[model samples]
Target: MKLGNIEEDSKMSPAFFLQRLPAQRRSALHDVINIRHAYHKLCEICEEVSEFYGFTIFTDMAHNGILVTLVSYFLLVFFIGMIKVDLISCISYGVIIVWFAFQTTVLTSYVTRTIIQIEKTANVINKLIRQCAMNKKVEKELLNFRCELAFQKVKFTAWGVFSLDRSFLASSVYGSVHQRNLIYVKYIFFKILGLAPWKLNLVTKPSKNRTAKTIICKFSYLGLLYNVLLTTSVFLMTSYFCHQHNSVQAQVDSLVTPSTMMNLQYFAVILSSSVFLNYTCRQKDMIGILNEIIKIDKKLQKYAFNSAKNGNIIINLIFLGHLIICSTLICLQYFFLQSFWLAVLRCWPAFLYCWLIVQYTIMLDMMEKRFKFINLNIVKLGEIKVNSEGLEPVSATRISFLRESVLYDVVNIKDNYNKLCDICNDISDFYGLPFLKVMMYHGTSTILILYFMLVAYYESKEFHLLLFIKDVGFVLWMVFQIIILTTFVNKTIDKIAGTTATYLIILIQFRASTPN
Candidate 1:
């Protein structure tokens, strides 16, 4: 969702956009107030619809995925039967269970996608509000616009929920809905349709809330617990063979599931889920962002009453929430890895799901760009004078105005504006981050993870032929991982990056100091 420099430059150019406005003389207090109010109302409607779409869509899929996954597991259990709990039966059960899990994942992803729409709508509304606040003329006329926008937002959001519920119920025909024994065709015909083809792929009509939270909750808990148990088996196996066997058979068992390998897989799952969960939220998060943007815009109505402390505090709260959520999910990931690391990783479908989670997290972080809302301060009473074109030059005119401005530099305030624009533009152009450069930053960790897998493989394996080749391969992999790790480490938590860089920088300095 990030943009490039030119786009940012365009947005920052107040004069350019203001030129598109009606003639200055015609731009009286009353003339454009209605138009602004209309736009604001439209934005509110979009916001409500988006919110409804987000919450309902997520809950629908989550509840349904839980149901389908449980049914899938039960079907696998039925297929395997109690009489045969042997290796062949176990593998069969796992395969079927994985199939069911994937089916549920598809619907979950769909609902998750709505978050993006929500985020978009929210951003738009917020931008509109910011504009209204910044305009002194509009502010006087559009004082009542906020109340209307709020009302419309609530109304549309309610409708969105109803629509989402219907959408999910109908579209969930691809899997077992209720019991494993009830065939898909029966449910499709009797429960969903009664021969009504229109309501086939959506959900049950009349929207009686057949979401079945109980079934979903029970199944999710069981599925998660089962996976955990599967991971714990590694530890159990480790203990079992630690002193039980001494021969090659014992070595074979230990070799079958290494703890470190399991740890790596677990780490991967955490990394992946962090991305996926965040991405799911990101899909429809724009709606909320827009809403928040409007609130910020309203706050800017009192731009002269600004405080750096409040600004920073608001920003910190957002980052803090993201950290807390990510941390909590990572813990869940560790448990899953500890219990069923091999089995889950071995399941290619599950692996993709895990990977998707990480991708989403990275994207979610990237989508959060609040720095653009920096308030413009009017310092001296006469500093905010109209230009020949009647547009704001983005700075105070008088040197004495510096004391009252956000930058506290009334002199050449245009320069400060230009500086912020330059940074925004460079980031947009160089990093393609009109907003946050999340994907680019996250790429570091993903690359490091992949390199480590290859490194671990080559380092542990033995081949007598051309022994030097193995050492070269190991070194190559290590270097690759280190490079990617360095970039990500530099951006996310720079102190760690600084500590590492000090050594490298000093080495570079030493090499230069030695004068070759």
Candidate 2:
């Protein structure tokens, strides 16, 4: 139990080190430390996955060679599609081939690994729960740890289009296949008619000139035609070569199988349940603790009310931001693509983005509201009035009761504060990295879309008003989405800071009011 021995043992055994700490510190750190330990295990698994997938270079040449071959196989098909026997095609089908091939492998890997990781974590939690059946304290801690695990569940989504986890891939497979086929068919139809599949008429301004319309139409048709040819060639190459190569087929089939699809669905359900359990339990836990903190005296009620009033605007702002973002995403998807199914296909990323924004906002809002609620409780306890000397018998009894409440509140406040701190730490640990990844994906996708818009503008002879409107709306929607996302994180940080400051102020006031 000595500090020196504890320090020495910490490197080997954190749980042992924790046991030797004082009771309050032990309770506060136990869940936080254990959750972090689980997170480290996940990080280790990610590294191994990364190496296996050739994201990291191996010292072994043979392993590196295999990685190179896999990457080169896809790249070679794309490169071949780019060449038209004499010169490179203007349609840039190479990009499409590369995108699809890369997406196929990466998403497949992500889906498989994510499902396995979730299953492993779920198994671990179940085992821990069973082992701690008789120990309520340990069981409770394990439950919290499981929640933290679910919140930070492994996912691999590179940009909005390629992110495939078990749940997402399984659900989208049929629709995605149909959409892909539809797009391919459309490209073929346009090609047969000698029209461009990629070209859409854009207008810089209104024009009634017959010659201008003809010239603009011709330019669009040619541009679209070039793109169509390249993209179709790439798709043809991938399908044909995939059939010829057993290795490629095996790699693709592993992710597309019925068994793999089922696993992904199961993963989604388990992770979703864990996330719900954690948030629901955390809310109830906080409310229960607040009740304990408020029980000491009736005087603290008014202070709690005032604190809640102060936070009303923040809660409203959070909700308002979510509303705006959700609307923008829906409009972006629906407005540009006239076809319901095509819009759904193209705007799925925007939809997913909106969902994440709402999910994170709701969770953060709950935490922020609870933080303010607890502050109000603290204020109520702070304002309790002591009975004055020479008061009547009833008044004296009331004052005595109020004074006794102060002692109880003071003793328990520190413990409650520690618990609140644990709640905050656990949540941030659970959601921080995932949020960061989401933000990065949004930013990158926005940039890529903008690049395509610029290319379209440059290539078009004249802008069609309707096309121009759609482009502007799409860009604006992306910007708004980014704004909403960043604001979500910023608001949470602000709430955490405000809660911390409130804790200090209450502690100082309580100590000053005491007769010590």
Candidate 3:
């Protein structure tokens, strides 16, 4: 195809060139070009409207509403499927499922079609540039149009977080299911450890009434009893072993040795476990603290705190590392002692002690995140420029509204900070004794391990490489745990201090901005 005159073609509509083309080609090109133009115009209108109001005004609410509605329907269908329901009910559920599936399919199909149509428009533009006799001007315009089409392609999003397309449905479902499963896994892990003494009520919304019901489970008492009995057994066995070892050593007139250090370490572990058992007795308080923390997490989800994801992974990895180290030490004990039951009895307290420390450290890390999030908000408030110069004069009412909003935000942040402080106090009260015991155990163990290592290196006649390596490893592990625990605690303290400093800075700025 050939355009007779470039100037004339430019003067007429771009679609005028289609008149010279074949009937079939002309109709298709005309339709594609018209659709592209219409889509472009529609996108511009949507953009302007979105900018005038707000892009994400109802985004979260819409997404949550849809998710809840679909999930509720699916759950209803599932419950009906499980029961011996009447024929009408079964048919109704089947129809509901089918209707939802059909609706989802239709929505995705239409979105896919629109995307395909946009793609086709670009392809048609390319074909016209190559197949038709076009000047540099026409080719440049076509290329520019193609670039615009590519740049401004239509795609729906959920609060600008993720695209809504065929994959969205699958990903949304997968994410929801995975999250539910992960919560259960965490609950099971904590339940096994006696850290979570209460029952997990996944179906019911978390509230005071539900909390009471969940805490009423027999498993909580059983877990607590099991921990108490285990602590007692471990302590008694450790005491018996220490007594027998000391008696033998006294008869031989031996000085402090590796075996002696081991006895001391076992005692330290027993002491830590005993302290932890004391905390485990306050299951109701623990549950309440956890529920409050959950509420804090939910409240802060709108802020930068949401970016601090993969917390579960960190917790799980810490637990896994603890498990590996303890298992290795236990295996070594089994190999050397040649008594499975005795090795387990001797090593169990140490494992429990480390596990308790890990739990305490995890809680500290969570608190630190919340404090950090609050500090970030405070810093952001401090950074807000109070004086807006070389701008349109804002109305008195608008300025008053802005001032009220800022004050409201500050009040809300202050309230959250106060609540966080209360939560921290509760955590401290809950873990205070256990933390002290852990610190004592770590300090004594470290000094003894180091002293023994030094003595073994210089004064000992025979040095067992494996035993020496194990001693070094144990000392390093204890030091590492102590460092991690202290680091989280310090970070939380620092964030709290920073929050105060931020408030003072903002106050100074406000004073400086005010007229005398």
Candidate 4:
């Protein structure tokens, strides 16, 4: 039942493991595919030994982290299922109503705390450990212990910290990305089905003949598609809710006023906006991961192919294109929230969406690692195809190309940092072990506490929140209209692709036409 032995670990290895392993202990380990490429990227600089042998901190976790998160999520869901609506209302009236301000404060504090944890944890572990071993007699155990220490910190830094804390009352960043994609995908096809929007500028910048037509025919369609998808979904949903509220108000007009209907609508919009915005930074991280990976691959080509030395390029691919996408989501939410209070409540569902995404990331990270091992093993055992593509087989042309990529003709680690330093590629400059320990130990637990505070605050004043929503429904309803109109109008190809003069002209004409 207990998997504590190399025998079990060997069982986890791919068929190719027997041939590829330099050390038996490092062979035959469990695989987690989610972010293995990212690990491969990071391990380049993350490795501590003079040997340049890289092992991913995440890939080696046997994927227990994801399992743990899932268990936590299910429990949270179970508790929510037990909550009664009337009880929520009573609590909201008595306690939560009094604490809305405090909840806001807590949310602010939590987001800040999580960011700090990330900043602190992304350290150059290999450099630090080599520093420790420079003068002292290096024991094998010490090496292992030091490596584990640095890894423990990464276990809870940046995204890890974000995932843990952000999941408290709402969902996870992962969930939000999925939702945005789903919502946008559905909307685009149903209403604006033509071509996908060209997100980048190279395609849009005028160059050859008929640039306007090119922009319209080639790229505008994609933007329009996304716009149509989002607009249709938001407007349709808003219209449905507005219709339902109108019908209910007809029956209860004597009891509640139109102003009351508007307030409740506002509250719901707040919830939606919050959910949408959290995905912003997530998109940035995705890009970071990809950039790191590309760099690592280049590094490997330069260092390993020419010489017989085993070079592990430190490319943390997990930080790739996803970051940009997530950041956009965050910005999207921010704009949505700025429009109304109803958008705030949407944070919870967004958080839920995030939690689910984190779960998959963990799973995929595991799977990628396993497959990497299988690839390595296949190459080692000569099981690879004669045309084996990715396995970096040694050849003259490959070695020559690799040499060109390196900063210098030299490839020795002894000279580079004068210590066991790996190239750590990240946006942040500050990273260390103390920061990591703090993150790993505090990241999840801290957010959990904050989430609890949020829940408790809400639970206490359920009635007031209901009343608040009831009072501001129409103002909130305006948010739905805003998202629909702005998304559709701003994204319009002809309008967006217009020259600066066009915008000025439109602005002037509109003002001149006004009754004021």
Candidate 5:
């Protein structure tokens, strides 16, 4: 029964015995050794990736350097032109450049992090390749590792405009061009939004405990404050900008200047860029959680399988919504704005930004709900007792195995949950300041657009119905975008409250059931 004792009695080294063993035994030994080696290689890769990802000084400096240079150049030109007639315009341009530089810095930081992630993955595969050359016996196993690493490469975008890699850039452009097909767009619309009736089918059953409701309400209100502050900030920005100019016409023209329009569009694009970074980060986070879930000793693959299916559905829905919003906004701009070509040039950036924002928010909402759903299911698993419910009689050995499996599953679930929490914290760290900037800048843009409309309405000697509708529609679109944006954070908070409650209940029961 003891292989070590048998080998010792044979007076042979382990490798010598391995070579002399029966063919089947030798094959099994070879396999075990290979698996152990592969596992060690994978762990080393993970450690290297994690270490490189944390040391982002190089990426940080590169990204920051570009922005700082641009800001310096703009500042120098602005102050040089101060003695000229466009004093106020120069100040406005300077402010815009400063804001743009700040946003670019934040966006670059995120891109740098993603690049490091990709680089480390490549490093892992290359290391495996090198090992394969040294160990011809494990070549097949190393090849498999290479394939898996290739499959797991993080495909990220830079500012949602172009792919991080040149190859993906072509594919992204094709996808955007594909949206021009009205029939395809319509088909997708029906596929996602048309499936609304089935949403109830997918919903989790109501929880028996209602304590989560009160907590959810509290968190919802807290999230609502963000929406309120954003709206209030818009009004404050409107007043400040309006007071800068003496005449109403001057205010309107100043806000609508070619430079102002371009800056606003650029700001929207940058704000939308946050969505690409955030969405990619969340996905990477989910992959980490899923990996841990699959590592549990229990038959956890079934649960992980279901979770992955649900997550994919959520991601698909978000993509569908993004496409729909993009098409709608583009059409809206053409219908409402001046010359078709000019309108497309000026308005496309903001519209594209809106689409990305909506996509990001929807992804946020569904991801939080998915996390809550998975946690609640885990809690239910914890509630099952070996002897508390009716069941077929089993041998003591079987029952003991069952009990151990249940405990192991629960412990693994708790560990994975903690890892998921860390992912949330990472998201917050990445999004916090950039989100604030977006809300503040977007709020100001919305107010300026509204004020521009008001100034137009009063200054016109004759009533223009078409002009009024366009103005009102623009304002309405901005308001609607903000409402949708705020709902994502609110829903995420509510789901978090429910998840926390479920976790607490499971912990309490687990403690009570533990023997002294």
Candidate 6:
């Protein structure tokens, strides 16, 4: 029956009626009242699980599980649909597809049912309210209960990116599939270079030996040896080339000037050596920084809806494209001066240097995102919604909520900001010397390349298209890297300043509105 009709007919609320009933019935009502407390406990358990599993850094287990199953299902379907495989292969694919489908169905059905069951409590509460007349206190209690249910919903999310519900199957499948190739490509590249920070586990269980082994295995000491060898080889090759072109006339006659090539060679050597030092000598500090980042992300989860979108795929793709184009140009330049093998070996230093720069840029981008998120939260604290009337100040209730919830959030934000600043400091300390070398090299190289390009254009009888293109490309590429790095640095600083200003504004407003 409708709630209005039941209210008209009822003499007393079901809760009041229960008070008059036997102790046995009252005891049962006590159990019903304890559901909220039970739910709170469940939430705590889930959070603990999330922390243990490092779900904050990556997708939750459920999302990964579902995504894997769906991908496998699609792959099998495609193989079977194409009808290119033999009978046995087709049969195997069919069996696997069926199993995957079953798993997906069971998972989705169970989660959907759990959600429906939780929602059914509201209906139960409404039934109780309608069964008998509710006194103001009982009515208020029921209203509060409903409000709690409305505000505090239990949702299963994949790193807070998307909810895991019926509709999630399609979106998750599509999204994972779309980004899979680029993600794998970048993963492989970083993995090969041994510069992937994420290779180290952020969340460690209480096993020191196991953690140590993982660190060693993932970031092997061999990387240091490899870098040393590469740096030595580049230095030797550059020296050999310089020795062969001892005369200024010979160097000038060459397609790629010895000085320009030497600048790039030294630049590569510095970057390679820095990467080696970062992974070997400062491995512990690097790991500590990553752990701090994870901690910051976990805390920021309360204030932010999703992880920072640093556009890893897009950024990596751009870097990869640049690598291809630059490598091709460098290879062409080298072909004229040295043997094929030596030329390829010479390209290694440049490649490694570019990789290091890309990784560095990505780190800065992530930090900038965190700063922006913090600034956004601070701005939110100062915001007041307005209506058709001139201005509507935040309600006392809203202000109280902010004091209870966001006041602590403000403190945490401040702590996170400080931690980020420290992380940036640590980063600068680690990369400062290498970055200085890079700046010096780039500045000198730019000037030399421009002057040479002008001389080559004006003094030479014929316009060398290849040399002109290479010079222009190198200058533009260096400028682009500088611009990107500076942009992120400036944006991060702006965000930090904005956060401080907003925080101060809110504090002043709070103090001004308070009485002695």
Top model by TM-score, which number? 3
Can you write out model 5's per-residue Cα lDDT over 376-433, one digit (the tens) per residue? 6667665665243336566768757767877786776666556556656655554565
lDDT of 4 by residue, 246-347 (tens): 543331233346665555445433333332222222334333433343333334343332111121111112222233333333334334344232232223
Q: What CA RMSD would you report for each candidate? A: 20.2, 26.3, 15.6, 24.3, 19.2, 12.1
Candidate 1 lDDT over residue span 1-516, tens digit each? 111222233455689656733443144445446455666665676566567566765575567567657655665455434233567765665676667556555744554455444335445545544543334544444445445445543222223433332233333222233222222333232212111111112222343655411111011233333334533553355434433432312112233345544454345444433433332333223223323333443344344322222222322333344334333333333343333333223332222332222222232222222222222232121232222113434333542353244234333333433443443333234222211223332344345444544555667754333223433443443344334333432343343233334435534643453324
For candidate 1, the TM-score is 0.27
For model 3, the stretches where C-alpha displacement exceeds 4 angstroms are 1-187, 203-219, 233-253, 257-273, 302-317, 382-393, 511-516
Predicted candidate 2 versus true structure: per-residue lDDT over 383-412, tens digit per residue: 553223223354657767777876676556
Candidate ordering by TM-score (highest first): 3, 6, 5, 2, 1, 4
lDDT (0 to 1) per candidate: 0.37, 0.48, 0.64, 0.34, 0.50, 0.61
Q: What is the lDDT of residue 170 in candidate 6?
A: 45
Measured with C-alpha atoms, the lDDT of residue 348 in candidate 1 is 25
Backbone clashes counted, model 1: 44
What overall lDDT, based on C-alpha atoms, would model 1 receive against the true structure?
Answer: 0.37
- Better candidate number, 1 or 4, judged by lDDT: 1
- Report model 5's TM-score to 2 decimal places: 0.42
lDDT of 5: 0.50
Prediction 6 TM-score vs. true: 0.55
Q: Which candidate would rank higher by lDDT, 3 or 5?
A: 3
Model 3 TM-score, 2 decimals: 0.58
TM-score per candidate, chains pooled: 0.27, 0.36, 0.58, 0.23, 0.42, 0.55
Residues 272-357 of candidate 6: C-alpha lDDT, one tens digit per residue: 65665565566566667766787787688676434423344445556767666665655665645445555555555545555666
The window of 10 residues in a row where model 2 has the poorest summed lDDT is 210-219
**Which candidate should be chosen as best, given lDDT against the real structure?**
3
